[model samples]
Target: MDLTYSAQDDAFRGEVRDWLEDSLSGDFAGLRGRGGPGREHEAYEERLAWDRHLAASGWTCLGWPPEHGGRGLGLLQQVIFHEEYAKADAPARVNHLGEELLGPTLIAFGTQEQRDRFLPRIVAVEELWCQGYSEPGAGSDLASVSTRARLEDDTWVIDGQKVWTSLAHLSDWCFVLARTEPGSTRHAGLSYLLVPMDQDGVEVRPIEQLTGTSEFNEVFFDGARTEASLVVGEPGDGWKVAMATLGFERGVSTIGQQIGFARELDAVVELARRNGAIEDPAIQDRVTRAHMGLEVMRLNALRTLAGSGTGSQGPEASIAKLLWGSWHRGLGELAMEVAGGPSLTAQGPPYDLDPFQRLFLFSRADTLYGGSNEIQRTIISERVLGLPREQKA
Candidate 1:
């Protein structure tokens, strides 16, 4: 398999690198490292403004077809853009759910009207989005989604709870997975509906994390309503559409995430040097392993993207999830180790965690969110290895 970038691709990479360098240098320099994974609350409005600046510059949604308000960039160029953005330490994006997840899903499965209604807003960052997938008992077991919606004339009324919904409190829209056909069970009778978040019946309560931050929330949709036409695909087709959205989640954007991961690793390594933790053989060994593992992850993700293109990743996406999740959690622990005794104490009595401390705490969920490692393993085993499905009790 070819891993080399074409000369044209390399030139595109240079263009991306130059653009990011120019974009993040002056007025946006303060946002260089803010509003990332665990710190979405940092300078949030500023980040929102920065995201609009990106939209204005036409830097968003590079992989979508040009007819859909995108640049229609190829796979390698998209990868290059993400890589350069991370290298430039660009501000954390404020619209990943809308841009990365939903936009591509619509391009593939959504009706023309759905595209016309949503794609431009998503491209322009006019509406922020959150995934309404995980529920109280159905975090990774999507077929167990208990949220229910029923059509009422021109609207669909929804009622249910969604837990661990990222950015639900801040989102202007939610794409919900609900049971539309009453008695059907296990992946049937479900629908993917796009619901607005500002109505009177919707409630979002922030879920505080171990890092003392709340990037996700518990949302209660009590008699919430949306137009009946908002369902992404036909009824009973949520499983297919939702799976595709999740597949899109594992796309080239992760290269930017890995670049951030590399920065964290570098910090840990520098601490090891200054604090003399590098002298410890075990610490040295773990550090080496972490660096090597990240390289492996980069290569594997490139291979997966090359074959799958944009929105249609297969079982290999599960492998990508499992690899990065475990590796990140391990890096968090290693950060604490390298920080030595100082990692335990916060800056204030109430608590102000240093970056490493926050990383250690926040990365704890790396294996849990966006499909748990256990779920990824199950997908790989059942779909790739020809294994039988595990029976439910």
Candidate 2:
């Protein structure tokens, strides 16, 4: 991967930086550094407005094709935009589920009508979306999903439950995977359906987390209905389309996530110094290792991006997931350790968790969610390394 930027890329970076500084100053100033992981409950309405503001300025979907209402920027320019946005500590994007995951899926797999109907709304920040792949039984084993959907006269009827759905309560739609063929097992006979969330057949209940937040939720679809044409790919081809979405999930946005991770590590280091934990050899060694790991992680991500196509990522994306999931979880542990005894206690009566405390608690799930560490390793071994597949009893 080229480490040097051309003059045009540098100019583009300046444009992004200037826009962020100018726009985030007055009315949106309070949104800076708000509504991230563990803090998703903060500034709900305000952040949604900030998202719309981003859309209006044409900064929302920088990488999408111009035909789809995006700027259609090159890969390096998109990278610069994400880095500059994170550097400004701008409000966490509220529409990432739509922009990053579902938008690309539609462009790559959706029919022309699907793209015409969904892409513009996604770019405009008018319709937010959530993923409905995980269930109580199929958290990491997506092929084991039990959600079933069948086509009636004009609509597809859905019935199943999805857990760990982030921002379901605020979303306007859900892209779901369901069994459309009876007696089909594993990944076969599945269809990817885009179901609306406001109908009477759908119910959403928040799941409180260790951080005392309910950003994640449980969605039950009794007889939820969507247009039969809402399916992304042909019936029984959901596995291919869903896997492509997963590839997009781990795409260029991760570079921005690593930038955020670096900021978190910087905070941890500052805490260690203030508490004199930096003087301890053990603490110092761990901090050095964390810093080095961040560098390695960034390099690997860039390399992966270089090899990946514009719309889909390769199996090497699993390596990125494994790296960051483990690194962020370790950073959380380091934060608590540097804080020492004070980290053990809540500062207030309501059991409030400070930023570091929340980091420690929320990062515990990093290696578990998205795809578990075991699942990532399996993908790396079987798909990337061409190892023999694990024997299924």
Candidate 3:
């Protein structure tokens, strides 16, 4: 595959970069400068405003059809746009679940009414969305999800729980997967539904992480009701729909995140230099390794996109996830080592202090989220390598 961009692609990149620079003005600057994980409510609102601004400019959904408020750009242009957006230090948009996952899935499988109802709200950041896939018992083994949504008259009555739901507390809706058939086998009995969070019988409780923040939540559905029209695709075809969302989540979402990771890597290098650790041979080696790891990830992502076209993720998506988890873990460790005792204490200036300390703690979850590294290995071995399936418990 040719790594070099065509002349037209290069021009498109310049246009995107210029647009980002102009769009990220006063408040955007302040929000982007806030380096740590936590952001104030005002900051989040400002970020949403920026998202809306991008949507209005037709840059938000770069790869979507023109009718859907996008530029109808290709996959490479979309990737370039993300890369430039990160470089501009723009505030990260909070509508990722909607823009990155749900919107695309809806386009592929949802009815025209469903698309018209959700896609516009998603683009405007007027509605926030969360994924309801993982449960108390079912996580990496997603087919084992037992959240039941039984048809009751014209509505589906949902009852079960979803754990580790990111931003669910602040979300307006949840794209959920639940078992619609009692006797049918796993993976064949499920259905996907989009349920409003404000409705009766729906409860959301925040899950406080070690970082002292409630970014994720445990959601309960106690006979919650959703119209049958909210269902995506036919009943018993949910596994396929869920996989499509997961593939987009694991593949394209990683592209955006890796751009952020590249920025973080640069911050690490700068931190090392300021701490007088740049001269250390070991530190230099770690920095080089981190850069190399990110390059490999970039190439892998490009290869996957080029080979599949239309950003359809394949088994290699799992490999990218695995590499990302490992690379992030190593980078975090190296950052902590370079920072020494001061890294543990979080009292200094946010930018001057060790950013990696928080990153290191967060990296612990990287290997586990969106299916664990062990599960990725299983996918590679069984699906990619054509190995025999392992015995189940």
Give each model a TM-score.
0.98, 0.99, 0.94
Best by TM-score: 2
lDDT of 3: 0.82
lDDT of 1 by residue, 1-393 (tens): 487989999888888888877888677888998988678889999889889999999999888889999998888788889888888888888899999999999988999999999999999999999999999999988889999999999999999999999989889999999999999898999999999999998999999998888998999999999998999999889999998888888889988889999999998999999999999999989999999999999998988888875534777889989999999999999999888788989978797989999998999999999889999899999998989998878
Candidate number with the higher TM-score (1 or 2) = 2
Q: What is the C-alpha lDDT of each candidate?
A: 0.91, 0.92, 0.82
The number of the candidate with the highest lDDT is 2
Clashing pairs in 1: none
Give lDDT tens digits, candidate 2, residues 260-316.
Answer: 999999999998888899999999999999999999998988877876747347778
Model 3 pairs in collision: none
lDDT (tens digit, per residue) of candidate 3 on 28-78: 667664422433233666676777777777666667787876667888888
The worst-scoring run of ten residues by lDDT in candidate 3 lies at: 33-42
Counting only residues 3 or more apart in sequence or on different chains, how many pairs clash (N, Cα, C under 3 Å) in candidate 3? 0
lDDT of 3 at 95: 81
- Please give the ranking of all candidate structures by lDDT, highest first, separated by commas: 2, 1, 3
